[model samples]
Target: MKSKTLLILTGHTKGLGHAILDQFLSLESVQVVALSRSSLDLDLPNVTEFPLDLSDLNALEANLTKFFPKEESFDRYILINNAGWIGEVKQVGKLNPKGIQRVMNLNLLAPMILTDAFV
Candidate 1:
């Protein structure tokens, strides 16, 4: 039997993340765990989808274990932190504070927290 390969991906519902997920799913030995604010439409046997908001730091921290459980089951583990939010395109000085915070939380804080939990 082929060894199990686990892939944890964020922002997997569209764009580049979705493309990467498509490529990974083609390999029969790989199992994909996807996290996105919007649920994915894929119904593949090897895919597990988690609809989540990465901007909520408290919820994300509390649920880290649920996303990354004991690693003993897989022969290899891969984490792809592809989720990001590009805040308003205006100048930094004119940017809204709340928007900046939301972007930072999603693009920076969430990935760091997830990476720490995965490692």
Candidate 2:
């Protein structure tokens, strides 16, 4: 039997992430584990969806184990950190603290945390 390919993808419900997910799903040996704020409306046999809020650091850390189980069934494991947020367009001086915090948490902190866990 051919060894399976495991893909852990984030923000796959729209845009570039969705495009990548489509192409990967076409591969017969690939299985996708997708994490996003909203679940994807895909009907593929090999797709597993996890709805998550990346802005919550504690929740993300707690859930990492669930997404990344210690299993050697797959020949390859890939992680795609595709989720990002752009804060409101404004001068730095005029930026809202809460908005900036939200953007930074999602775009930078979450990816770093996830990468650390993955590595």
Candidate 3:
């Protein structure tokens, strides 16, 4: 079997993540696992979509243990944490409590959780 490079990319539906995914697809040796809340609906070879809501800690934690099985060895493991939120553009007091939590969960907590598993 050919050695493969595993790329775990978040926010792959748009922006820099989208651009990166486009580039990675050209390489037959690169295996892409796209993590996004949105449906990727991509019919490309060597690509897998992992639909996840990063804002939900319960769901995020539950999925980590099996996200990348220890049995599988890759030539290289790459994790791109591109998912984030800037939150509402309002005063702190004016912002909804849920929005703050969403920002924290997606921006700060999710990347840490993913990195902890990746490395």
Best by lDDT: 1
Candidate 1, residue 90: lDDT: 97
Compose the digit string of candidate 1's lDDT tens values, residues 56-102.
88888877887754654888999999999887899757989988889
* TM-score of every candidate relative to the true structure: 0.90, 0.89, 0.90
User: Number of clashes in every candidate structure?
Assistant: 0, 0, 0
lDDT of each: 0.88, 0.87, 0.87
The number of residue pairs in model 3 that clash at the backbone is 0
Error of 1 at 27 (Å): 1.7
lDDT of 3 by residue, 2-113 (tens): 8789898989998998999999999999888888898679888778887898888889899887667465678998999998879789975798989899999999999999
Tens-place lDDT per residue, model 2, 30-102, is 8898989998677778888889989888888889888864664788889999998786999869999988888
TM-score computed on alpha carbons, candidate 2: 0.89
* RMSD (Å) of each candidate, 1 decimal: 1.7, 1.6, 1.7
Off by over 4 Å in 2: 70-72
